[model samples]
Structures are given as C-alpha cells and as structure tokens.
Target: MPYATSAAFAHDWPDTVRLVTVEGAPHTGAWNADAYAYAYAYAKELAAFLAQHT
Candidate 1:
C-alpha cells in the first residue's frame, strides 16, 4: 500500500481524525527510533503507574 500525499490527508481529515496505518511496518522499528523512545517509555511508565495507582 502507498501513503497518500498531504492533500489527501487534508481532505480526509478535514472534519474528522484520519488515522493512517503503515502497512508491513517493521516490528519494533518505532521502539528503535530515538524520537520514539520517549513516547514508548512514557506509554510504559503510564501503564505501570496506572496499574499501581488504581
């Protein structure tokens, strides 16, 4: 599958949230990206914190 251009996204998400999925995304690639580290860590910390808090 191919990703649509910005124009397509603009049209699709104009009135609603248009979510895109990466087909065949490499497993754990996001975890390896430096930019994604914080997000992944935050998600883990939030999950654990919620479990303990609740």
Candidate 2:
C-alpha cells in the first residue's frame, strides 16, 4: 500500500498504531531485503514495537 494510505490508517487509530518509514526502502525491503541498509533498523523497530506491546 502507498505510504500515505498506510499513514492515514495509522492516524485513524493513533492510540494503537505505529508507523515506521524507511526512507529508501522498497515495498518489502524493510523486512526482506538483506542488503538494504535499513534492514537491521527495521528489525530493531519491530522488536521494540513487540516488546512494548506484548
């Protein structure tokens, strides 16, 4: 989905939604692209989100 759409969805549920944007990452790059520079940061953000929510 487009970033704007995602951002809007998150905005609709501000209390329970979190948005993480990787500036140069592709559609799935943040999670699946090993060579992408921000892959580790994506994982770290996901971990942090899980830790906070769980």
TM-score result, candidate 1: 0.36
> 35, model 1: CA deviation in Å?
2.1
Q: What is the lDDT of residue 54 in candidate 2?
A: 92
Q: Residue 40: error of model 2 in Å?
A: 2.1
lDDT (Cα, 0-100) at 1 in candidate 1: 22
Clashing pairs in 1: none
Please provide, for model 1 over 14-53, each residue's C-alpha lDDT reduced to its tens digit, 9 standing for 90 to 100: 6543332333444344344454654766577678767867
Residues forming the 10-long window of minimal summed lDDT in candidate 1: 18-27
TM-score for each predicted model, relative to the true structure: 0.36, 0.59
Positional deviation of 50 in candidate 2, in angstroms?
1.6
**Candidate 2 Cα outliers beyond 4 Å, as residue runs:** 24-36
lDDT of every model, 2 decimals: 0.52, 0.75
Task: Specify the highest-TM-score model's number.
Answer: 2
